[model samples]
Target: QTYKFRLYPNKKQEEQLLWTLEKCRLVYNDMLAGLNKEEKPNRLKLQSMLPELKKQYPELKGVYSKVLQYEVYKLFSNLKGLGELKKKGRKVGRLRFKGKGWFKTFTYNQSGFKLIDTNKRLKSLHLSKIGDNISIRVHRKIDGNIKQITIKKHCSGKWYANMVTERNNKKHDKKISSVIGIDKGIKYFLTDTEGRRIENSQFLKNSLKKLRREQRRLSRKKKKSSNYNKQRIKVARVHEQITNHRIDFLHKLSRSYIDNYDMIAVENLNIKNLVRNHHLARSISDVSWSAFDNMLSYKAENANKTVVRVDPKGTSQEYKYGRDLDRDYNASLNILERGLASLPQGLRKVTPVEIEPLQKLETISASLIIETGSLFQNHK
Candidate 1:
């Protein structure tokens, strides 16, 4: 698990952090330049060049050793990512050197970092090169051994520290009981098999007026001027606000479902392909279906629950009854049926109820709709 905390670095410490980031970027570019010249690039050879690099450029010696080495690892990781894309027949580009202000993060891997918990609410993160006593606000207690700490500077001029940790998770033997299938949409955030609906909180859409005003103000400023930089941060703040609101809503909604259900079934949507449709792209992005699915998966694993992804094909189009069923509700039922079918025979405890008469299913659906409407009204 990774825990992110707000960092409050002093002016001198902030300058040190920025200097380290720039130094790491330079090292990354230097290694890339060397790799391009060589017929066969070796990781070890590139790493060994660091000591010599410090001799040539003595400023690097001021930065932490492992922190500089991580830049090499990051370079190869990018190369591997590009290779995977090329294997899938996608157009790939070579890694380019980072320009000024482009690099915003630096990592202290395995060593050169310490977390000191004061008796007070605030903690301090100590780095090797950067000064100690950098106040950190850890909202929640961090469990497990910390593997690394990555310091990042946001476009909004905020600093954050992400602590990656390692821990052995105990396996949970939970009996499959409550089950649900959810169909995601633009109108409602989701509709479940039981006809419950959660309204979509269009954070980006709601803030577009303010965002447009900020952008217009930014556009009026001269490029690379002090005013331009200040206005740029104002625009970034609006985007940051939208992101935080969306994430908070998703966290609460996903947590509610996880707390109530044992198994959750959802459509395995190819979000990248769906976003290609220009008309629906904005709505789809606003809904953030992929982010919600990811939260459910991770949270379920921690709780020893189950999350199943069923093929979305014909889910909305196929209906059993002669009368028209709600598209999202029908899709959710199909999803639930498919989810149960995919489970092992012994584990498949609850099967979809088979209602022969159309009138009975319609009545149940109507009643559920009314119940959900009341709940939404109360929530509002």
Candidate 2:
């Protein structure tokens, strides 16, 4: 995970966020002006200049706002790169300066960060302006120090607190005793070489009917009415529940693979092209193949395992029932059943590494011309 820890922000916390954001915005604007004048815009000097700035620009309104000492500078440091505003340079999403309302948002530095506290081996988190008794859940014990903290508010209006830490990297081996090829399809989420068929959870499919019903219920209520707002939240919570279920399923499934397999080989799906097919697009998203594979990688890395991605061009098509390739794709998914059928019983936990030339795999016969995709993009 990129970061850890949950933020518990109350009403008072919300005010503080707005305050900090506003001040950070001012800091960035002044710096930009200083740079234009060939003046140094250092943080230390900026701290000292705040009083004079407030004195000169009374309209900037100094006395009414909360003082800066209450919050630390590390957590919500001024936006630097794209944050500094690119000239013409096109960008998506609205770019707005941090306003006074953002002071409740806290910044963190390598210092404001801290060790995670566990019920087992004790560790503590230290906040610069705050106390050290912040409670955090320790899932994996590791050697590390907190690097930074970022607290954000999600689109769903929920507060999230993240603690970025420097942790040790894990190591795993390249296991090649066995190889399994997986084909992810719309009908079935996955069909593996071992004949372990995983059914599609189809969370979106299952939730649509109920979602539409709730949506209609929401529409019936008057706009801007209290009842409408209340019903909207209810509808949102339902969708959230379905998403939670899918996320949990992906996490568990990926973990199971990490714990059991030393290597996992999967097709690189071109999501862009796949989504163009309206008929199967919804089904493809429901399975969330990309997310599953991504989670599998880091989790496997942590366990000292490997993830082998083979060219997926002819995986399903090359092996028609009862047919053999004139020249087998360097490795064919269809023939996977034939290839591993003779493996020892105790050797199911490991898989082949990415040791073969992908060009060799690309030479196999495909039912149709396969376009360049994510799989090709990742080829070594």
Give the candidate number with the greatest lDDT: 1
Candidate 2 per-residue lDDT, tens place, 5-82, comes to 454445665555544456555654554454345343355555556567667655445222223422313312432444
The local lDDT score (0 to 100) that residue 14 gets in candidate 1 is 91
Cα error, residue 349 of model 2, in Å, equals 12
What lDDT is reached at residue 288 by model 2? 87
Q: Can you list the residue pairs that collide in candidate 1?
A: none
In model 1, what lDDT does residue 38 have?
75
Instruction: State residue 146's C-alpha deviation in candidate 1, in Å.
Output: 1.3
> Where does candidate 1 stray beyond 4 Å?
354-380
Error in Å for residue 61 of model 1: 1.6
Q: What's the distance in Å from true for residue 29, model 2? A: 9.3
